[model samples]
Target: MKNKRKILDWMLLIAWMILIFTMSNQPANISDSQSEGAIKVLLLIGIDANSIFGQLANFIVRKCAHFLEYMVLALLYINVAKHYFTKKVVIISTVAFVFTYACSDEIHQLFVQGREGAFRDVLIDTCGGVTLLLIRLGISSIKLLKLR
Candidate 1:
C-alpha cells in the first residue's frame, strides 16, 4: 500500500510536468487567443475592458497562468519528495527542482515558433513555486502548534 501511494505521487508529478510542457508547446497565437477569451470573461463581469485595460488584463491573465502552473507543480514536487526525504530536505529539494524546471521550461519555449524564452518568466515561475512552499510550511507549523 505504501509503495502504491508512492508510485501514485510520482505519477501525478510526471503528469503535471507533461501538462506544462504541452501548454508550452502551443503556438503563441493560440495561447494569446485563449488568454483573450479569459479576458473577455473578466469584461463580462464589468472589468472596464477598454483598450489599455484589455491589454493589461490579458497580460495579467498570462502571468497568472504561469504563476498558477508552477504553484501546483511545486506542490506536487513536495508531495513526491516527501516519499524520499525528511521534511526539511523535501522543502529544499522541491524548491530547487521547481526552479530548475522553470528554467528548463523557458528554454523549451525558445524552440517553439513565435515564442522566446524570458528570464522574467522564469523569475515569475520560481516566485510562484516558492510562495506555495512557504504557505504550505506555514500551515503545517500552525497545525503543529495547535497539537501542542
Candidate 2:
C-alpha cells in the first residue's frame, strides 16, 4: 500500500507540474480578427453566465480553478515530505511550501508580456491548498470513525 501510494503520488506530481507549466507558459491570445477556440468557448460561456449571475459564476470559476491548482500543489508537497517525515509534519510543511510557490507563481506572472500579479489570486491559490488539506483531513477522520 505504501509503495502504491508513493507511485501514485509521483504520477500526480508529474501531472501537476505539467499543468502548472502549461498554464504559466500560455500566451495571451490577442488578435482582433481571430475566431473561436476552446478557451474562447469557455470564456464565452463563463461571460454569459456571469452576465446572468452578476459575477457569482465568474467568482466561482476563478475560485474553483485556484482551488484545483493548489490541491495539486499540495499533493505534490505531501508526496515529497512523506518520504522523510511524519504525516502531520508533512501536511504542515507542504502547506507552507505550496503557499510560497503560490506567491512566486503570481510574482513570476508580473514579468510576462500581458500578465500582472494580483494579491487576490495568491490568496485564492493558498486557499485552494488549505482546502485540499482540509479535505484530506476530513477523509482521514471519516476513515477513523469507520474503523472505530
Give TM-scores for every candidate, taking all chains together and pairing residue i with residue i.
0.92, 0.73
For candidate 1, write residues 11-83 as lDDT tens digits: 9999999999999999899989988887778778877554556457777889989999999999999888988
TM-score of 1: 0.92
What lDDT would candidate 1 get against the real structure?
0.90
For residues 1-148, write the lDDT of model 2, one tens digit per residue.
Answer: 9888888888887688677656754444431112223234567666454455554654555556667878879878787678879987988887787788778877876776676678888888888888888988999999999998
The global C-alpha lDDT for each of the candidates, from Candidate 1 onward, is 0.90, 0.71
Off by over 4 Å in 1: 44-52
